[model samples]
Target chain A: MARLSLNQKTTDRWSVAEAVAGCVRAGLPSIGLWREPVQAIGVPTAARLVADAGLRVSSLCRGGFLTAADPARRRRALDDNRRAVDEAAELGAACLVMVVGGLPEGSRDLAGARERMAEGIAELAPYAAGRGVRLALEPMHPIFCADRGVLSTLGQALDLAERFPAEQVGVVVDTFHVWWDPDVLGQIRRARGRVASFQVCDWITPLPPDALLSRGMMGDGHIDFPLLRRAVEQAGYAGDIEVEIFNAEVWAADPDAVVATLARRYVTHVLPD
Target chain B: MARLSLNQKTTDRWSVAEAVAGCVRAGLPSIGLWREPVQAIGVPTAARLVADAGLRVSSLCRGGFLTAADPARRRRALDDNRRAVDEAAELGAACLVMVVGGLPEGSRDLAGARERMAEGIAELAPYAAGRGVRLALEPMHPIFCADRGVLSTLGQALDLAERFPAEQVGVVVDTFHVWWDPDVLGQIRRARGRVASFQVCDWITPLPPDALLSRGMMGDGHIDFPLLRRAVEQAGYAGDIEVEIFNAEVWAADPDAVVATLARRYVTHVLPD
Candidate 1:
């Protein structure tokens, strides 16, 4: 069977362990867990469940929001990231994805803010490698470029990856962030095997300036997933195709149903040849 | 006094001729007119006032929505673009900036959607060039990826730029849309003098999802205009920065106040070196 990983965030309706167990039960070959899910059930128990199900942990959801201007807080962020890497390693995850913080809170210096992000990533890259985890930097959508992730383009992420060899640092091209990029095809070709993760989600415009939590499911919005997956696979990406949707509606629905629906859609639209 | 270019959409709050005369009398050095404004006033009169006032037309706001699957309609769009180029030439504008269409009315094929965009641009480029007008592709905010412009990242726009030469084609790097790009600096640098126009506006977030028209005025939002301008200038862009705000509140205000406010913000924040 072709590989598929269900990101825990999609079924955030369930706890981390339940998500892991449920994904395995649904016959998914792999799963991705977020820190919140692990924290809810405790990492050890969550990791144990994945092991119990023999589910491959494609990656830990994230470990990089390093935009705090305070040096100590930024250092603590790195320390926490090392812990995330360690946790991912313990769970046998192939990579530790980093969202990389947006503009430091209340700060508008997008350039200095991004420099801090690169510095933060550089600090954690070696630590993540030591923990035996590949660090994947996910350049978010330009919409998130201001405060959530300063890195908003794949070319920028690939540019940073150029600083590290293919082994240590890489990029995660998410449909939610980069589906709209005009050069995504070229950047994916450039990323090739260095693309550590390929995720699927839809971009929705949320109201309330601080409405940071709403996202759509794969096909509910306008994202062209089949083509996006084709681009990633064409770029020599052989890793798990993870479904990492962050939708308020899905989270509120029956977790089992969401997984079932996603499975059906993935089989029809995303399963590799 | 430094140069000022009026985006006629700004004065969409007024009739086209009145808006043009107001801007000319206000001592603005240049102006940008939208298709609707030109249509409302008749292209010849729109062209004549600017010519009579000796106002340099910086750019024509748009001439693309190339996502129609119907070849006849798509051909109509290209033909309309041909007319837009002629109108731009009449007004002595710099380029016919394209917000290259979004998904075809009912389809979700983003890649195919973009292919349609490229095809339209390729079809329109020659006509625009023959009329002494350049096609300036604008990369809008990701929020509009579905219903509006799908080219969301500056890297994407630059990649599109690589498809054509600077003289015949280029891009309009509007900060309101792309200031959040992590690759903004690199892309802007890559844009070099091929930057057909530099547009400035503020970024504001409205809750719930009415973000399309909620653009903030400079100095009122999170954009660091000075830094962005510096990057654009460093990228070898020597173009007049035009304020293309789509703010309802700003637009509702007295046009004079709006222009004066923008000029003040421009002097304080975006004064070129």
Candidate 2:
């Protein structure tokens, strides 16, 4: 319970202030934020709101989508990521989660997309580090590989992260994305000091029409959460374990009820020890 | 064109006889068979139909689902796989593509399920080898890890395959499955002598509601088909390139048109050289 955090996505209807208030009501120690909501109230006010509520900001939702082949779009993406880094710094977020972009429109060049992703990261890592924000690369599921993320494995995330200092570039171990990797336990072990964030969510089946919202609550799916939790703990990730889910039903539910449910699930399914 | 083989699922509307006749009409030298339709007419007759058409059986549709934890259910799964092996042998399939089962109805023990999958393969591999049929373990896309194939990566499939004699057990490299793997090229290189089957299909986005039927035609999606095709070719897989798609739209279309479109896509998208 002490280490539990409520990621904003879990209570999708909540704004920055609303999520912070919900976290405080739930007695959660922290909250993970998204760029849009934080920027909505402006980062300074959002930062002071969380600080006043006595909550830690676990992470900033995202900052990557750098796989543009077009030079103008690529430059704009890098600039946007730099702004994201500044936002993370202002919010005092632990890290900026990076959901590296998928293939460019009408493009079949995956290798090129991936190479551009790496280059974007390389360009952003130093800027992020200078702003006191770590870039946490989120290795999304293979299902999202065609449209959302090119980094499909934790090992692949680590490959890019390893190019920079651990404090500058790290990987986010989101269970929903990585629970199916055969070498996940090994990859978690390899993550070691570079694990910037640990997110808990279940990978549910009979996926919704929109696959992006497919993440289920921990107890409702097939993931061995305790096994992964133990592995992450053993890998030396002692930070807040954020419960992040992106399900339409969850989004439609009462934000407070969503937080309460995730809080309970975090105890029973994520932190049994 | 010489290596092109129309997987039965690609032409979903076609019966075994119809698919074989379609293959003959398309001037395709081979056809991949599925158990349901083959068993509809029985194996012996199905075998003769293809033989009579002078079409080689590239590989049988499947022969796995071996991850049951219950002893009785496990035994049944192994027996079903053995029958599939015999059918593959009778049809003279190049190999038996195995879509290994997912988690049991209510179980979360992926490691346990994987162990049982290996044990089942160990039990069936020798029987398959004796019948001159190789068990080509198909590492399905991670999207299907919970409900379909627990084997999610080609490297993971090879890990299971290398534990057995290559003649008894090998792997199926489906482009749609392994395309997202970061280590896929290296894994293919590692799969040199053990490549039993090479399946090709495009992975499209805004995946259909079923998710299972999300695969698109060759040029209809974002996959770099030529890249994967070249990787398999360099892996020394001199086998039939079976185009296996599972889209509802493709299924509803004319089977002959599907075959003709795939034939053109195979040349332009798959084997540009």
The candidate that wins on DockQ is 2
Off by over 4 Å in 1: A165-167, A203-214, A234-236, B21-26, B48-54, B106-111, B150-167, B182-193, B205-208, B230-239, B252-254
In candidate 2 the C-alpha lDDT for residue B127 amounts to 90
Assess the local accuracy of residue B29 in candidate 2 as a C-alpha lDDT between 0 and 100: 97
After superposing candidate 2 on the true structure, give the runs of residues whose Cα lies further than 4 Å from its correct spot: none
lDDT (C-alpha) at residue B118 in model 1 = 80
- TM-scores across all candidates? 0.88, 0.98
In candidate 2, position A102 carries an lDDT of 92
* Least well predicted 10-residue stretch by lDDT in candidate 1 chain B: B204-213
Model 1 error, position B126 (Å): 3.9
Clashing pairs in 2: none
List-wise, what DockQ does each model earn? 0.47, 0.86
